[model samples]
Target chain A: MVSMLALLITVPMLTAVIAAVCRGRFCRLLLLSGSILHLGLALYCFNTRIDGRWIGLTSYSEAILLVLTSGLYFAVCCYCCSWLKAEECSKKSLWILGICLPLFLATMTLVILSRNFGVMWVAIEATTLFSAPLILFHRSGRALEAMWKYLLICSVGIGLALLGTLFLAFAARMGGVELHDLRISEFLNIKESLNPGWFKVAFVLALAGYGTKMGLVPFHTWLPDAHSEAPGAVSALLSAGLLNCSFLGVIRFAALAPDKVGEFCTELLIILGVLSLATAAFFIIRQGDFKRMLAYSSIEHMGIASILFAVCGIEMTMIHLVAHSAIKMSLFLLAGNLLLACGTRQISRISGLFGVMPANAILFLAGVILICGVPPSPLFFTELVLLCQAPLWLALLMVLLLFMVFAGMMKNVLSMTMGKKCELEIHAAPAERLIWVPIAGLCAALAVGIVFGVNL
Target chain B: MNMAIDLVLTAFLGICLMLSASSRLVHCIRLVALQGILLGVLPLLMWNWSKACPGAEIWGAAFVNIMVKGVLLPILLIRAMRKAGVKRELEPLAGYSWSLLIVSVASALALWLSRSLTIPGVSVLAIPAAAVTVFTGLFIIVSRRKAITQSLGFLAFENGIALFGAAMHLEYGFFVELGILLDVLVLVFVMGIAVFQISREFEHIDADRLNLLTDTGEVK
Candidate 1:
């Protein structure tokens, strides 16, 4: 089973290498085959646990990650088919996508299976290394800057995570255990005996460190730059997939901490999460750049996840993670379609997308509604659960945050989809509808889960 | 003996700060190199007083730290600087004086915070030294305009962390040493590539100029 977990990581990574070296149309086929194989492997892990060793990779969480990543990876693959249609002189950006796509997926898999904290840190850092080049795939001045901010900020964040790992190592040291032995269960088993002060310090550092990657506010400065400037597929992975993996790292640490310390940690997460949501809400309301607006939405979703985790609302968190992944993937992929049609991501210049690219417009409309947590959406249910469990004050705060996101995001997204068409012509092919299939599927699944209470 | 080693590290860490505040990029790089050399010998200095019985392990760890963190990484960084053809700190996003002030404050906080928890493996000197190293690295990462200098800051940050861990008596010295070594080498090379890419695109490697992708949040 451990070997299977290892295979889950290696297969995509190795495939990425092969895909990077492969030429022409073969790159897309190779990437698709690799993603499909990954989805299958994830399903195998979902169905049967290897003696129930890993928590998130076992039973329900494994299924959630698999379904979410598969949906996300599929959207990315589809986007690659269109998004990377290079001009004769244009460098084959597909090779870069091929190399990073699997590596990105593999890193997320590693994060889920990582029982050892040290291994988890390595995986988180690996995500940065794999994705940095992808962010710069366009090789534009904007892409270069975004890549730099992404690398510098994330490296420092991960560096602090390393410090926290060392602190946790220190905590383990006083317990007279090997640093490798600092597993969640092992830490929890010895939680009370370990130094409370040191444990608190470790948890704070880990939260800030991993929180940076998760795109929580204050530490989230790198997020907008990276997300807005990267190719749509990379943006989708950053939003729908990568953030959750880092959240899992924090969750792993939180699970091990004692109740009191857990409260302290959650308090910090909740504060950061709420701040991130509020910050995104403000930015999204007035944000001119469509891609940058979506970047802010990513921050909001991350904040929502952090808040749920803080309340110890695990079911809500899982639903939100899955729902946000699906909805955000739909939104980013549609944004890509818009980019192709309009050749600009500036919201002020883009209007009446519904008329210009009707298929994308409809998908974007659905995605916007779903993101706003309207009725029958999975996020609506998850948000409901979060409100119920939250303290009265927090419930009020969440309502305000949700309303801000709804209003702000609705203003921009609605204007983009509903306003009068500009002079630009939409050159979308009939095959572009395939990209909408996953969005429709996710929306339908979410609707069924909401109404029928399908234990998804 | 531990105190003595701590004092030595503290002095080197001070040199690192002075170098960080220096406006000259080459001087900053050189100071980082000196600090790396000092970090290389830190484990040996700290372990000399330990009653814990050991032979080549401590020395071996020190040798690796010196060779990897001290010598190899600095040389690579210097080469990157030369290749990029950037000298002197360009107009930093954050001012030099403020960056220095923040570093000092973070160092004080690290020192004060160190006293709060009495973890067994950490020595008095190791905590402040590590804290100073981390703070200086952060300042460099945040304030420096050039990608290379920011990376140099990161190297110093790692040096602090490595020294802290060395003090902690993590048993697998060889593995930790190798991990840190590989981490620095790989990260530096990756960072070097990013600098080259930045220069190729922008004709300069200043991070502040790269903020072209802001959310259109100005409420017009």
Candidate 2:
């Protein structure tokens, strides 16, 4: 019971080391077995209670993120097996991918499970370090550029978060709280005792810091480039898994703010939320790269998630997070398929995905429909909740941006998915057989929407 | 003891100034290493040896901090530098004089700002120095063009944060400190590999020069 989270984090790390030394086929089998074991542990912890000094499932939010991360990793694992066989990478490169893939999972697990702010910051930075190598899977020049920006920008952002954590400690000392460290349970115990002035600065610095990793506006410069260049499975994990960890970081700090500053914290999130929505709205309009378009969609949904957390609270935000994960998982995986069958990332260069890979095209279209907050999806309900709770002008502005983004995305997606057949390179057979991965993702989103139906 | 901390910080702040003003990447790297050694030593000076302290353990951790920050890390960056082959930040977006001037003014503002933030029971002098060093690190990162120089900028940034933590006497315990150290080591190593590759892939490591991906005609 005490070591549940530790077991979960360590299993993947062990998988990574063994995979590095094993044969390629054994490595693929290890990834599959490893993720299943992780999913089982996550499910077990959800039903029972667990706690430790540095790691635990202490809240509803932590459990939700853990499940989402593990579920997404399991799905991405199947896709990765297919991805590996499909792409003809050298043995050394394959070993590198094998090691990075699970280590990335382990670090992300650390981020979600850490009960202390300092440990959380360290884990988040480690995620950046590990995932950067995953982006180098293709090793193309464009991929290199994207990986560099992703590493450098997110590191700088997490750096600010470290400073913010330090300030929070200083605030505790100034406010006369007798805490030994930056543990979450202890911080909540002395919540009212923290100095408000420094608390506010710490919160803002953290928001901006993790906000960079979350890909909120003004800090989202790395998202599109990285998402477009990274392989399909990696992008799926990135959008579905990594961004949520960053959001968890923000929400964890926000949870520590005193009651007096509670409203102030929400106001800051609302402002960044609306700003992110606006930035994504402006850019998602007429994006040329299909993958980049999907990347923008992630920013849009993350914006809406922040707003959901601010206006409707954590329960609604968790629902939106799960829904966004499902949809993005499908969208990115299907985008990878489209890239395979179409042989081009630009929307203008390819058409008639319906004519070639009809299953992937349909999944991609469903993902688009879900992400745009259409009926039958959880985002639809979450956005509606935010719109009703938010002030009048903010709601109106959100509606406008959502519509503009919808139009921009559908315009590009329609052109690609529904035209005459283009010349096909046809290197997509392995992925073709693994369509169940993304298909399961979409179904999971619908199921979640149904589950979230009356729970709130 | 306070005077010693202040003296180290003063020199640390001066290195940041020289870093901002210097155009040659090698010279800047040497300054970053010097700055790092000072930060490593600052923590040992700050550690409170209250009664019955684990003197050997505490001292050993401090020594590791000094060795890792002061020596090992600089050697890693220098090797990567030798591999990356460029030595000067030519035509940085912000010229050396303007950049140095901006850093100097920002340092003054940081000094003024630190006076108003009353952190009790610890030397406050390192606060302004850290703030200024952070500003200078950020300045060098943006102003300089070489990928290697960005590494130097990050070194300064990491050093500044470490210095601030020491100044405030904020201890995250030995395990967390070791973990953070390991993370930074991996990060710089990854960055070193990236710089080496960036040089090979682009045939030049000017970060700004690698701007092929843009949002133009993206989705307007």
Specify the highest-DockQ model's number. 2
* lDDT of each residue in A235-319, candidate 2, tens digit only: 9999999999999999999889898999999999988988889998888895888899899989988998998888888988998
lDDT per residue for candidate 1 within B1-220, as digits (tens), equals 6666767767856875695678877787777777767766665665645576546866676677677766777677777777778877857877878877777787778778877756554666667777777677766776777788788888777767766666565433354446546656767877888888777777888766666665543311
As a whole number from 0 to 100, the lDDT of residue B199 in candidate 2 is 91
DockQ-derived CAPRI band for the predicted complex in model 2: medium
**What DockQ results for candidate 2?**
0.57
Candidate 1 pairs with clashing backbones: A287-B216, A288-B216
Cα DockQ of the candidate 1 complex = 0.42
Per-prediction TM-score = 0.90, 0.97
